[model samples]
Target chain A: MQLFFQHLINALQWGSFYALIALGYSMVYGILMLFNFAHGDIFMVGAYIGFGVATALAALAALSALALPNWVILVLTILIAMYLTSFVGMLVERIGYRPLREAPRASAAITGLMIGIILETGNLAILGAQRIRFPSLIKTQVYDIGGVVVTNKKIMIVVVSLVLMLALNEFIKRTRWGMAMRAMAFDYVVIPLMGVPLNTIASLTFALGSALAAAAGILFAVAYPVLDPYIGITYGWKAFVAAILGGRGSVKGACLAGFLLGFIEIFVGAYLSSSLRDLIAYSIILLILVFRPHGFFGEPHSAKLRL
Target chain B: MRKGLLLVVAILVVGLALSPCAWAKSKTIKVGINAPITGDIPKVGEGSKYAAEMWLEDIKAAGGLQVGGEKYMVEIIVEDNESKPESAAKAATKLITEDEVLAIVGPQASSQAIPAGEMANNYGTPMISPWSTNPDTTKDRPFVFRGCFLDPFQGPVVANFIKDEFGFKKAAVLYDIASDYPKGLAEVFKEAWENINGPGSVVAFESFTTKDADFSSQLTNIISSGAQFLFTPQYYNEVALIVQQAQELGFKGPIVGSDSWGSAETVKLCGEACYGLFFSTHYAAAGATGATKEFIERYEKKYGYTPDDVGALTWDALRLVQKAIEDTGKLTGNLKNDRVAVKDALAKIKEFDGITGKMTFTPEGDPIKCAVVVRISEKGEFEFYKSACP
Candidate 1:
């Protein structure tokens, strides 16, 4: 039982990265009715941007000119990286997606995939093939509670992820931009009739999603501290699955499903043979999706109608 | 009409610019390097390339390889396999057919080397794998050869090291199911451990796929199972993550690994978390002498980091190929006969002195070599521990 709790703690932290990135996929899918397949590469780009900004700040601090602590520099790195990466997300949507808006959905999906390849290869070309090590921002302190061991970084990751999700929930509930997004999801033609520009909502959605992915990227760096060009490929795909399982256009569903997927993967690997973890975990998820095709919080409506 | 004429002229110019292979002389021996140059393990590829280049430079300085009193300069052509098995086969085929090289050097990983070795066998070209240790890499292929010992051999080396040095019977294993090297090494180690320490001595056995980054669940089980030590034979990237995660789970026992953990990047990636871990490797830089020491200093000067076992094995493979080419008496300028001669010569190599150490090939083309065990000190350096010979 104690071992179960220990794994649960790990599952929570692991799920936070998925939940954070999945929100980007769910939101972009919800608002624009287009899956940002490049979102995973965007997450990768965000992590690299985080690495760059964090490295610069750490170097500056090492100069002893700023007299700033590591934690303060880390906070600044996360905020700045998110802001810069949001523009990248917007640029991708603008140049890549906007050109194919009137084209077939397959074209947009293909464009997203192409953009993903470009980002990955571009990073490889620019940075060379060497893997970059993310500088440690916060000192790890292990907190022993009964038999379960938890690190300060793990707690911080979980808490920060929840806080970001809550903030996003509040923004979507209370802001006019959130209202515009909701209207766009329901009917794009109707949203323009309400005097809100369609392009503005699309860009805003991409921006928001990219920012969340940036947060997840920075948090992942905090835990793993090893940054490679291709780290986002598998991570992005798994989060996309979480986004779908949570239900289309449902933020709450994405969060819940992300954690659920993490729990399933962890428990399966722990209780059963780890070799069978993905086989059984993904199979269970497939059964759930088979019964509920629209997903847990998805509406029984066509995606075209939502667009 | 003018645009069309200009386009035709441009095509002619470009075609002329690219057809230099048609005018190449056959005086020099053409060697193909089939390494993974651009994908997941580019560092491994880069190391192999540099090692080959370093040997070529030294060979040129010594007035090239003498065959029947005729000296032939070596020319190396590198092809990127993109780190995939099919890509490796395609690269090897292209090297044999298009480039028409005499002998080839790599396809470093077992997954690539196994398929590429088969292709070399089909083409009747002698190919030596620098770092691939899986038994299947050269099992049935007479034309194929390897520089490193088989995974089965290293498995007992690690198991016996832990038993004799650490004296730990109870152990845990976590491996990558999708990877050929890690999976093969893990199975061999488990069998050896059980045979030496008794059956059911392994308390926990877990696995993850190639795409997995989180290993906390498996670590939790291993910790809770009360195993005295852990064995993970995955690549350096995965090993770095596993070590960090293992430490966070409060498992303080010694961690044992394979040659895959012998890279300098493991320390850079994992920081202090990988300190004090032990692994069986090809060569250790500490306490080295003669050619091994010289190779280490030159490699460290050329590349920023110290040479790992992969780099050393690649150097060994290059020297072995050069020696085989010279031992065949002459190139003869006949591709088919020369390739056959090289293959036969490589088979007859009774002994080879390499930077990795002395090695001799078995009838099956696998090397009978000594495996060195190294430990990561508290300062995060690979310290020489001991050597295990078969």
Candidate 2:
């Protein structure tokens, strides 16, 4: 039972990253009907930006220039990094995607891959191949409840991810922009005819998704704390799997499927063998997709497919 | 009269250009350094380059290397392997066939060294890898040599060190399955541990692919498996995450590592998490005496940091090449014969004392040396703890 609880905590923390990044993929696909393949590199860029911000803020605190606490520095780092990385996301969409909006969908997908490569190589050129250690903002405190072990950072990561997800959920449900996005998801061509502003919705979707990915990136750095240029490749592909398994354009489904993916991976490694963890975990997901066809909350083929 | 003068001037210019090539064949000894200067492990390449440069400075100060009776000026041709096996092989081929170097020094990591060593052997050139510990590196290649003990030797060294130091009976092993070095070391360690404490002594054996950052599930299983210590033979990048995660998961026992944790970046990235942890490596930079201390001091003064095991071993490997060249009595001015002479001399080398250790070449071209257990002190220095030998 203790082992089970420990594995659960581990899964939740691991799942939070996928959930957050998958939300970006889901949102972009929701409005634009194109997968932003570069979303993973955007996550990498966000992490590097957060590293810069956190290091600067930490330096200020150390020098007594800013009378800020560690938690305050962390919050500022996340907020400032998200703000900056959103611009990067918008720039990528403008330069990489906007021109391809009228091209074939395959061309747009290819553009996303090219943008990803550029981002990764650009980071390598700027930072060199050395791995950077993310600053430890919060001192880790381990708590053992009975036989299960947990860390304060893990708790904070889970809480922050949940809060962001909830905030995104509310944004999609409450505002006029949210309604415009939903209408765009329903009928992108017709919604623009209703003065929905297609370009604005697309850019806004990218900005929101990038901001959330930045948050996820920072949280991930706090937990893992090792930053590398290629860190986004495998993670991006795995989260993409979550995005697809969640069904197209279903935010709730994407988030749930992300967690489900995490749980399956962790439990598989724990109960079976770590060597076969990915094999068995993905096999289970493949089985589920085979039955559901369109995933848990994915809609069946409808008139919306005409576009 | 004017045409004759022009012809004489042109002939003089041509002779001046061709004179150096004629002298270079016998009067100068050319050594090749195939290093990963641009790719994944650039630090290793940088260290090899710096060590070669420092060695060159000494040879320059002495005017030239004295071989048999005469002196020969030395030249080192450094090529970047880019940390890839194919690139390493390409670098070796370029060095041997194009540059016509008498000996080759690096391609340090086993992944690069194995392929590069094959290239050197096929060309019948003497190649010595400073840091490659995999047995396959020099297994059947007489022309290939290494400055470090093999992995098969290192495994038993670490196993005995752990048993005698802590009296631990059960262990857990975690390693990267995709990488050759870790996978090989992990198997050797597992077999050695089980041999000492009987079968089923390794309570948990876990593996992950490369670029994996999370090891919580594996740690949880290791913690619950009743193992005494955790042994992970991963590189520094993964070491920071693994050690920290294991600690956070309430695994109180000591975490052990192999020489892959010998990078300067390990302590820098791992910070206080790795302090006081133990790993078996070539040599400890802290508290050295004699030639090792002098080399470390000079290298630190020149490079602005402590030299890692890669730099120390590279220095030793280059010096071994130098000794082998000198032991050949004289360069025959024939590339093929001189290369064969260097190989034979390298194999016959006995009791060659290096900054890393005292080495004697085995018939397989591997060094018979002791492994040192290093403790990362609270001040973030690799302090010498104890020595383990076969």
Candidate 3:
């Protein structure tokens, strides 16, 4: 039972990353009806940006006149990294997707993949092939409740992810921009006719998704503490699965499915052979998708047949 | 136009006919270095390159290698393997056939070395892998040799070390199933442990694929299995995550590692979490004497950091190649005969005293040598702990 709880905590933390990254895929697909294949690379870029910001802040903290606490540095690093990485996301959208808005959807999807490769190789070319160790911002503290073990970092990661998810939910549910986005998701062609700026909404959607991915990247670094150029490829693909499993453009479903995927993966590995973890976990997901073809929250006939 | 074409064909034919004779008469002996310079484990390639360069400097100062009564210039041709098995084999083919090197130095990791060694053996070229410890690398290939001890030898050394040091009975192993080196070492360690403590003594044996950053589930299983220690034979990148994750999961037992932890980046990336942990390696850089100390001091002075086990073993491998080349008495100007002579000389060598340790080559071209257990000191240095020998 204690072991089960431990696995649950592990699953939650692992799922939080997928949930955050899946939100990017979900939001962009929700607004534009195109899969942002470069979203995973955006997550990678966010983590590297976080590493840079944290390192610079730590250096500044070392000075006698400009001393700052580690927690303050951590907060500043996350905010500043997210802010900077959002610009990167917006730039990618403007350069890679904007011109292809009228072209074939397949062309835009291919552009996303090309952009992802460019970001990966570009980071590799700039940083070289060395693995950068993420700065340890928070000291890890382990707590044992009964027979189950948890760490302060793990708790902080879960809380921060949930708080961000709630904030995003509220923002979409309450704000004027939120209404515009929903209207756009409902019918992008007619919403633009209703005095809604298509470009601004698209850019805003990308910015919001990238910021969340940046937060996920920083929190992942705090837990894992290792940074590399290709960290986003596998992770981005996994989160894309989460976004699909959650149903198209369903925010709450995406979050729930992200955690569900994590729980299934962790529990499978914990109970069965670790070697068969991915094989069995994805097989179960395949079965679920087989029955619910449109996923848990997707509307029937909502996927328009453009051809 | 017909006369010009005829003249060009004649010139090309003469150039091709005279090339081999010209190459044979050349006074320089080329040695090939096949290293992973730009791929996953670039640090291993960097170490091999630096060590080879340092060796070349000494040769240059002495006016090149003295063979028989003549002094011949030595040249090293480095080919990047990109840390891939296919690339390694391709690099070896290029080095042996195109560069026409007398001996080849590295394609360090077993995944690369095993394939590259086959190319060398098929072409009848002598090759030595400085850091490959898998038995199959030199199993049936006479032309292939290695500087480090094999995994079968290392597994028992580590198992016995744990048994004597802590007297721990229950053991747990976590390794990368996708990698050849860790997978082979993990199985060997499991067998060695079970042999000592009886069957089912290895309480938990878990594995994950490459590039996996999370090991919480596997570590949780290992912890709940009532195992006393954790053994992971993964490389430096995965080592940092595994150790940190293991500690965070409330694992209190000692986490031991294999020689794959012998990279300068391990301590740099792992930080204080790896301090006081132990791993078996070729040689400890913290405490040394005589030639080994001099080599370490010079290398550190030049490279701005202490050299790791790969650097040390590479130096020994290069020196071994040099000794064999010189032992042949003379280069016969025929590339084939010189290569044969070098191979024979290498086989005839009885004992070699390397910076790592004294080594005696077996018929299979592996060294009978000692493995040292190094403790990561508080200051992040590889401190020598104890030595275990075959």
Q: Considering only the true interface residues, what is the Cα RMSD of candidate 2 after superposition? A: 1.4
- Highest TM-score: which candidate? 1
Question: In CAPRI terms, where does candidate 2 land?
Answer: medium
Docking class of 1: medium
Q: How do the residues B1-390 of candidate 1 rate in per-residue lDDT, one tens digit apiece?
A: 999999999998898678976456467788999997877677788888988889889989988778888888778999999878899999999999988899999999988998999999999999999899999989889999999999999999999999999889898999988878888999999999999989999998888987577899889989988999999998777887898888877888988999988777888888888888899999998789999999999988987778878888999998888888888887788889999999999999989999899988789988899999999999999999999999
Ordered list by TM-score, greatest first: 1, 3, 2
Best-to-worst ranking by lDDT: 3, 2, 1
The DockQ figures for the candidates are 0.72, 0.57, 0.69
For candidate 3, the per-residue lDDT at A1 reads: 81
Q: For residues A78-124, what per-residue lDDT tens digits would candidate 2 score against the true structure?
A: 99999999999999999999998989989999999999999998998
Fraction of the reference Cα-Cα interface contacts (below 8 Å) that each candidate reproduces: 0.73, 0.82, 0.80
The order of the candidates by DockQ, greatest first, is 1, 3, 2
My TM-score estimates for the predictions, one after another, are 0.96, 0.92, 0.94
Per-residue lDDT for B1-390 in model 3, tens only?
999999999999999778873455479999999998877788899999999999999999999999999999998989999888899999999999888899999989999999999999999999999999989899899899999899999999999999999999999999988878999999999999999999999999999988888999999999999999999999998999999999999999999999999999999999999999999999998879989999999999999989989999999999999999999998988888898899889888889999999999999989999999999999999999999988
Question: Which residue runs of candidate 1 sit more than 4 Å off their true CA positions?
Answer: A303-307, B1-18
Candidate 1 chain B least-lDDT 10 residues: B20-29
Candidate 2 stretches greater than 4 Å from native: A300-307, B1-30, B38-40, B63-87, B90-101, B329-338
Q: What is the C-alpha lDDT of each candidate?
A: 0.89, 0.91, 0.92
Model 1 alpha-carbon miss at residue B387, Å: 1.5
Q: Compose the digit string of candidate 3's lDDT tens values, residues A131-177.
A: 88999988999999998899999999999999999999998999999
